[model samples]
Target: MLQVRLLGCFALEQSQRDQSAVLGRNGRRLAAYLFAYPNRSHRRDKLIDLFWTESAPDQGRTAFSTALWKIKRTIGASGRQMALHAVGQNVVLEIAKPAIVDAHRFASDIEVALSASCADSIRPAIELYSGAFLEEFDGDWVLEERERLEVLYVRALTLMMRQAANQSRYEDALCCARRILATDPMRESAQRATMLLYTLNGQRGQAIRQFERCRATLREECGVDPMPETRSLDLMIRSGAVFERIPTLLNETFGTGG
Candidate 1:
């Protein structure tokens, strides 16, 4: 039996026993959307509207039907069984039991990692996050899911960095912080974390340089100064008090580190 799972930012296929194939972009998209909204039946008109919004109405309908037929042909008998019922205007795909999807699994694992008491338990979960949800699909239907996944991605990385810091793994924390900042240069939490990691590891000069680069980027791009909290962090570094009161400084900065 083929197990198809979908949750949040992860999607996985188990039991490669079935060699089902979905050919072409539009055909693949139809299958993917149907799989994603398994509980809901979609109207033929609605599917046409979504995928061929820019095409002429008659042409769009023709295209939609062609794609649907392709999906049916690709999955063969399993495809026909998966098709619950298609009345004159609506078609529904049905599963006998709950489907397993990688997106859903990834979300579940991320939630557990977020709530875990130990960082070690969360490490493997973080590693499971391969990439954004449905990286291949760029339709309007997928945008919201992508954004939601991105936020979770950032939060997971942040949690890992904090865990490393708690264990005095400054180098590891620095690497995590840098990765976050690369994705979001304006992420103050990551910037502050990097600064703190540098300071803790006796790389005060590098820490100060990080601040300088951030200041330049913010000024050139946003025409704004760094937040007072980040400025204060730089001050702490200059005064040689960063290591002595690292936690206190982090608490004060809150959201202005990167």
Candidate 2:
């Protein structure tokens, strides 16, 4: 099966073997743009305007043709296999299907996981996500997709952390929560989860430190304070509330008390 993975960057293939040749920066940008807008056909002129915005109209068209040729050469397309089709003064490139792109796969997995009732069934699918859809690409066209995928990634990570906590894998839960917090420090659920994990591990000072750091980050970067829930948790930890309740709560909740 052919896959055109776009995880870290653009890659093309026939079957599992990659047929993608090393493209220069411009060619890579073109490929990234097309992969990002696979469903919609883009006009050659629009692409020229987007990438070669500094060039004159005629020069832009020339540059666009050069980019298209480079892509074709790199992907081993012959003749009209990857040619610009005229469409009312606008030329569009036709992208073929059954293509395995990372963003597509990530979206598919997210949909499946959302539909599935059993969290266990979605674990493997969630694990398939290594990073953001196209972590390196930061073009204006891709920002919306990037934000969407980031939300999905955080939710998947939260689910995984919850599952780990349920399984008494406090260490694993802590690690996953830390990762989520690193990406979005304002994610109160992840922060709460990390605090819970620290309390479970008897790292009271560390738990307090986590809360303090979260508070500092939010204030410094976002000009906001931590949520009431987080502040309450901080107060609880400082007043020995968490430690005092740990034995009974752990026994009743997880059925394992240390």
Candidate 3:
């Protein structure tokens, strides 16, 4: 079984072996392109265009062939057992193990955890999402996939924050909320969660600071003010009438204090 780790950096490992050989820079990029877009085979011309954009047509094709050969060699593919192979004029990465990609597993795990009843189920999924996809790689596909994975990570953090807040784990909740806000400053729900947790943790000033941050974010980004729910929370916090509340979209009643 072959495994490709794309979350932090690029690492290709065979199940039986302890590690993968060092792939050349172009070789790594070629392999990553195939892994990133796995559903369909890519035409030889397209692969050349994507990776060797600066070279002449013939030179680009040669460069792509070189990278593909290196990728195959690095993954231990041979004449009969080809990991990256040509199907007609198009090439495809036909690895034996479908679950060899960490990004795929991370996505599947998060999907399961989202609908799961047990909070514990989500822990592994959250842990699997170590960082942005292809953290060191810079390309159009890498940027898009990185954004997608980062969105997933943020959702996991939001869910953890809500779970912790429901369990009265104020500190943990605040930690998660802060993490979410750090990733996306315009995340109003996380801003509100941080404020509520700050008040509950006996730091009313910090709670106010969170609200101010939210207000500024909203004004700058959307050219709008905080919603009624946010203002209501503001009044409650300022007047020392703090209760167990959180950000919500539809209704004013997020939750009643227990």
- For every model shown, the clashing-pair count is 16, 0, 0
Q: Hey, what RMSD does candidate 2 come out at?
A: 4.5
Q: Worst ten-residue run, lDDT, model 2?
A: 77-86
Q: Write the per-residue lDDT of candidate 3 for residues 149-241, one digit (tens) a residue.
A: 888878778777767777778898888888788778876666766777898788999999889889988998999998877787888899876
On residues 1-258, what C-alpha lDDT tens digit does candidate 2 reach at each position? 435666655566665555555555666777777766664667676777788888889888877777776665655543333433546545455555413566777767776786664556656766666666567767767678777877877777767676777777889878778878877888876786687789877788898899988898889989999998778778988898877776554444334553
The candidate 1 region of ten consecutive residues with least summed lDDT is: 5-14
Q: Please give the lDDT score at residue 225 for candidate 2.
A: 92
- lDDT per residue for candidate 1 within 11-107, as digits (tens), equals 2233554232444666566777776667577898888888788889999888888777776554445543355456789977675543244554556
**TM-score for candidate 2:** 0.79
Error of 1 at 256 (Å): 18
C-alpha RMSD between model 3 and the true structure: 4.1
